[model samples]
Target: MQAFTNADMSDKGATKPGFAISAWPDTRDILARLYDLANKEPVLAIKREQMERYLGYFEHKCIKSKSMTSAAMELIPGGVQHNLAFNHPFPLAIKKAEAAYLWDVDGNRYIDFLQAGGPTVLGSNYAPVQEKVIELIRECGPVTGLFHEYELKLAEIINHYMPSVEVFRMLATGTEAVMGAIRAARTFTGKAKVIKMGGAYHGWSDQMVFGMRIPGIGALESHGIPAGCYEHTQECFPNDIEALAAMLKNNEAQGGTAAVILEPLGPESGTRPVIYEFNACVRKLCDEYGTLLIFDEVVTGFRMGLGGAQGFFGVKPDLTVFGKCVAGGYPAAGGVGGRRDVMQCFAAGLQGLKKRAMVGGTLSANPLSCAAGYFSIKAMAETDAPIKAGKAGDRLTAGLKEIIKRRDLPFVAFNHGSICHLETAAAMLMDINNPKIFTEVSERKHVMEEMGAAFTAEGIISLAGSRLYTSMADSDAVIDDALDRFDRVLGSVEKKK
Candidate 1:
């Protein structure tokens, strides 16, 4: 194997240091090339064949999982509760997970690259966080509906690690955190419009549903939601500062822009990476317009680092939303953090005394979750888990790229620290502004889903065949083993041809 290096990769420019927007201005061009490569006839045919073969293996080998999926379909929509659980052949009924591995009910062991959909950076079932959660549960019971010390501790730790977050408010889920962030932004700025990156997912919230995934198709998946819900919401192209500026200017004439929120690494956790200086540019824009800049870090928060992408990019947002690892992989893991003045919108008050954002949850900041989150952040810092996972990610990225290059395939693999994206579908390159985005995305959807099934069949689970989140558990040996599994899958292209 030729030792891999990202000598001419897209992430090199996407992850460049400092505030120069011109650095790596050709990122979109690099991405377009990858997309074109994946769409080639020979590559599509190979991927299609692998998808079929893998689906057959999944149906034949995973009898118990098939039966379970069938049973669950009676109650669960699409045979799974969460969208991530919906795999091509039937979702696997995982018996348990520890470190970087998962075991299905049928005794199948697989290397977990999904990482519970980008949360378990320290690895699934991380001992320290789990132990802390259990201890808290045994001691103080789960929820008190009152203040808890762990809440203060968690908030304080996050603020310490991410200085931009001067104050914080725990929430029940990423959806609620996002909703709260928007509410705070509106309350603070007294503006009615918000701008999000097209194709980025902030949550399934009614207002945020516009321009999801396929983009340009406002409220495409939101059948029940009325147009009024997203009327105040607008979308601009990812990495395109000019589009954002135009949207802001337009909104100002109607009603001033409240906030401009984004997944700082770009839509869908760097599936479409931004130019290195994009965040700083946005920061400058928001400052000029008096619009609160909110970074939806639910996926990027602790996964990127204690400070998340905001820390990595060195551009401070007025507000930040978090999820997943924020609560150490607990069931309810999310919160909002921001400057003291902006976060004051979430402060408790009497009904008529002060205007404030209405945000509260039955389980928000529960002792168990807070304890787990506090311990998780502490452990991540103590063990330098972010740096370790990032190194492992670099190794995995290099190795996967090597396989794709060696096989003469058009696939692309890149990573930003621990968060990795392997874009065989190259869906991000689709121009969301075009009316044809719907047809284009639909045409490419099958191969992408099949690619995910192929990875699962090869004992390598991924985030819908597109993304991988590496954790500290993914040491050199683990990454090597995973790369070996990936190579086997990629090598199947030769067999198919």
Candidate 2:
């Protein structure tokens, strides 16, 4: 892999030394290519025969997994507890995970590029973090509905890395953290409305669910939830600074905007990459509007580097949301950290003067989670795991690009450090205004699902066949092997007629 130099860093932002992302992607170039792919007729997809063969892998080779998921479907909705577990055919029952790999219940091995939905940057079931977590569990157990020393230690480490996070409060999941952040924002700013970049998922929280995955389709997936849930939640398209400014300006007449929350890298973990200067520009806008800026770093916090995205972008958000990697891939892994004044709104117990956000979780900041997070972060810093993982992402992305070019495929591949994206169908890029938008999106999505199954049959596990998260565990040899597998799947592609 190539070593990142200052020349490769984004000139528009100040990336701290040893941060994960070496080169900020050219957003205009990527968006242009994505739009072209989306607008292309007869979506290029894996051949029908090839797809059937790939599906056969689950039917024949993964009999145990199929049986297990079949039984689970009777009990669990969608046959899987998590969205990431769903696949084209069925969910595979993963029995074991180690650095860079997973073994299904059927005993089949796979190169784990999903990385537990972008949490395991040091890689799956990292031994160092696992060992510490086990030790803590054996000693004091997971949680006690009380305080733990590790909580303070973890918060200290986080503050050391992310100075913008002057105070921290742990939560059980990303959803809870997002809720807390929004409540705190409303309380601190004394404003009701919050604006999020469209298609950027802060979590499954009601307010954040507006315009999810695809921009401009507001409340399309908000079934069962009341219309009033997201009434104050407004969305603007990614990288559209002018639209965001106009929305902010408009919000002034409607009781003002409380906060502007976003994923600094762009929506869906850079699936829609943002311009290099986007974060700084948003910061300026927030400052101008007197609105709190919340950085949803659930996927980018420690994984992006210990300093987090705010540090890389050199734009300090008023609050930063943490999840996934916060507890070293352990359960109950999420938190919100920010300026002291705002975070005080989440202060536990009764307070006379200050208005509190009223956030609580019985298992939050458990001893096990805090211990695991502290150890994991220490190991990450000691080993420069983020930089190593980023190099692996760069290598994988470069290899995929080469294969795409050689095969003359209209696929687009890019990476933000360890978070790699390979858009085969551009399903998420479909325009909402098109008359047949739903039909087109569904067809393109099916193609993407087929591509995912193809990759899985080739012994690779990717996120929706489009996203792949590299880690410190993915060595040059590991990445090369995975590339060959990806090539095999891509080789079966055919333009749909």
Q: Residues 1-497, candidate 2, lDDT per residue (tens digit)? A: 11222233243544458798887767777888998888865588777798888888989999999999999999999899999999988999999999999999999999999999988889899887888888888888887878899999999999999999999999989889989999999999999999998888888988888989888989999998899999999989888777788888889999999999999888999888878877777787888888999999999998888898887888899999999988888888899999999999888777887787898888898898889888988899999999999999999999999999999888999998899999989998876765667778888898899899999999999999899999999999999999999999999888554
Stretches of model 2 off by over 4 angstroms after superposition: 1-16
What are the per-residue Cα lDDT tens digits for candidate 1 across 110-209?
Answer: 8888889887889989987887788888888898888899999999999998898999999989999999999999999999899998889888899998
Against the true structure, candidate 2 has what lDDT? 0.88
Cα distance off (Å), candidate 1, residue 156: 0.6
TM-score of every candidate: 0.92, 0.96
Question: Which candidate has the highest TM-score of all?
Answer: 2
The lDDT per prediction is 0.80, 0.88
lDDT computed for candidate 1: 0.80
